[model samples]
Target: MSASVANPNPNKSFEVVQPPSDSVTSLSFSPKGNYLVATSWDNQVRCWEITTTGATLSSVPKASTNHDQPVLCSTWKDDGTTVFSGGCDKQVKMWPLMAGGQATTVAMHDAPIKEVAWIPQMNVLVTGSWDKTLKYWDLRQSNPVHTQQLPERCYAMSVNHPLMVVGTTDRNFIVFNLQNPQTEFKRITSPLKYQTRCVAAFPDQQGFLVGSIEGRVGVHHLDDSQQSKNFTFKCHREGNEIYSVNALNFHPVHHTFVTSGSDGAFHFWDKDSKQRLKAMSRCSQPIPCSTFNNDGSIFAYSVCYDWSKGAENHNPATAKTYIFLHVPQESEVKAKPRAGTSGRK
Candidate 1:
């Protein structure tokens, strides 16, 4: 039994973490699997140590670093020595975990930085922005090494080492090979009608997942021969109320992905079998972001007024923003086996 599930709180289900003063835009677990980092509209990126063997959550962050504007995204480098954060200030900062956890601007985006991804093989970082461009940074330098212009602002992105895919505001599915960053890429039409809100690369790197605000998801395959395997489904919807699919994170080894939504619900799905293995009870408000640690034992997610069109209407109880920590059982994180006919996602 996982520590969290082994010792349950009679008064609540999951452990709640309260630190950020505003909406949390993104959450990531360190590669070391001992901490959870969050970027928020509070204009700060905060880190919290995980008590893997216990259920209590620390009310304070291990480190909190500020940005000029609301930070939208964050991720840890392959080693835990550094953390990269991006914000509405259009700046990307590298925060050294040592040295009092101070930050230094390493690069700048022409617009708010919506996402940051590190390419370990090339030892570079790529950022997407509302400026309709993706900038590649060497990290050791101050200026971008290369830039790729997009047709519209980037809304979501997913990367699998050599293969990268980004979803733009106009629903253009832009795919590229990072080994040759400037190589001409494939641009496919997104199958969803609403803006793409989140994406996740498949375990095999053969294709990726695309999610939209209309409570729908597209399972995409890269090759024409696998077109029949590509399909779309509806989720994040309840009766007549449609909710945005706020985020998606795949378990590091299981390929069972989790989805958080504006409905404040979290679901675990086996992408290969297309079966929902679990669903968390409805939370107070929307959950903007969620992530699994590299080992897939700890799950962290944020529930808040996600700045969606009708966010202000959420009740005060639900308006209280929070990051919840869940220590899932290994069995719960494992992907379920289906009949032999079930195929890859």
Candidate 2:
């Protein structure tokens, strides 16, 4: 078991595993919880296997494939036999996992796909793109089964409670009811002066967590009939822009949460106290996205530089991918300390 600390300092020490050079733009873990997939500005998607015997720092990727443009987002299928990615070239592609540990492209999108997600129970795929539209595709259909348009550019999104919540550059969130195709259920306004970068909903779909560029996170209750806000908190210090906020599956199970930001830092918070328990800076470049493993034992993140370099020349040498292993706390370490000085005979 990994070691744990009591009210651990926000800067508690943890292990970091670095992947091959590449500016990581997006990250997702496999459904089976054995691997992690990362997309980078190098137009490549790489997968790494998770192991508990201490990460092999110099190990190469288990699989890697090229895209036409910078891959902005990716996700794995429910069966873990395929991976999907969206890129800057206005395309969404599917890759099938072969028995020999190789991936082959199988499908493509019409526009630059910004995000992709697979619904396990419905056996459907959903995608959001710069075309200002959200499309739902049936695995068996050749064309999109449904599409929804948004008023502004979409940055990030998530689906919960059969509803799609989309974050936009305009600092607003739109909730679309999947059951009722024609209904626009709610338009959530952020309490920030800047755009909303990311949004995540609780596993139970009872509440949601929204991250803003102004470095704040708002927790809201989901209620269709009432328009009341439950509570909100300043998750980060005043100046650091919260690039992303992802609720780990472990957090719900362990009552803890984590957040990443442009400041190149990751913070762990306890739900009960709403206090920051741990913090660590993983990269010098900005972290665009991050997600926890299915088992909640590990998480992955991607780092890419700001506008100093040209987009086409964004090589893997300049980009980096990081995986953090959660060190479990020991019962003795978490136990209360006794009072008295050793010299008091």
Candidate 3:
């Protein structure tokens, strides 16, 4: 049988979903909020539906596709009508939603493709690679229409309309304004010295959150006045070793966000109040990726070895891993008014 976890704490109840055979590298919620696609080190992209009723996994994977190498990342496009995935194979494949269709190889990269994002406003697909380049694609034809060199291999990226932020391995941020594809956009130095692990946009698009492998996260604002809202926190660390923060995403409605890390835990923080609302139960292995379903009703996370120590950590004898479906309590994320305890004295 596949792995499963049932925490006795009714308040933090969650259901284990059908898991991939190998490690999960990333997870993304479909735009419609009904399903989620997980890209895994098993060389497969698996899609599973998110049901409304319980903390139980309602169904098995709706579809599963394979890649030549271990898949690393995935994203939805056309409002969930299609999906795109990339991996160590250096190939990007587009999968259609309707049943019985094969995926199309959309493009290729010189090195592993670290990220694949669809610019809905521009109707284009952008991919960042360890090859030290960012390329824009037009699905109608082969080969990227434009390509720009980067200072270093891109490890994380976040988009909040108008602006695109690419965080590289060398502690540099390459920011771009979607409107003017050209022109050298702004460059921002990172606040931390560790390798960037994840970057997520704020709901309002004014700034973003950057998380590092050293268990440090910094808040950044685009303008001066909002800069006061910025803050930094150290978490996911135990004694000396710091766990890598694997994922960061904002709640669509509440504007709050959740952070997951290699320590196998998820924590909800209310940025407006500078307080942690909750920290979910920890699993046996690390949670490599997580995301909130579009409507904010459900959250999915994969628990597996994320290769943080490189191939040396891979153990074939390791037990099976899993993906879980959690229904966060409304009260846990419900935003508090300024007068509430999270606000002022």
In candidate 3, the residue pairs with backbone N, CA or C atoms under 3 Å apart (3 or more residues apart, or in different chains) clash, namely: none
* Candidate 2 lDDT tens digits, 38-145: 887779887777666563322235778878788888888878878888888776677775344544343354567777888775677888877777777786777777
The true-versus-predicted C-alpha distance at residue 199 of model 3, in Å, is: 0.2
Supply the TM-score for candidate 1: 0.91
lDDT against the true structure, each candidate:
0.81, 0.63, 0.81
Candidate 2: residue 15 Cα off by (Å): 7.3
lDDT of 3 at 345: 22
lDDT of 3 by residue, 1-345 (tens): 134653222234455567788888888888865777888878999887766553454645688899999998899995778899998999899999655579989978999999999999988899999999998998997989899898999899888778888999998988888897655478888877788999987777777889988888888887778777788898787789789888887888888888888877888888877878887777767778888888888877877778887888777676356777777787667666666456422
Give the poorly placed runs of model 1, Cα more than 4 Å off: 1-13, 54-60, 310-318, 340-345
Q: What TM-score would you give candidate 3 relative to the actual structure?
A: 0.91
Candidate 3 off by > 4 Å: 1-13, 54-57, 340-345
Q: Give the clash count for each candidate.
A: 0, 13, 0
User: Which one wins by lDDT: 2 or 3?
Assistant: 3
lDDT minimum window of 10 residues, candidate 3 = 1-10
Backbone clashes in candidate 3 total 0
TM per prediction = 0.91, 0.78, 0.91
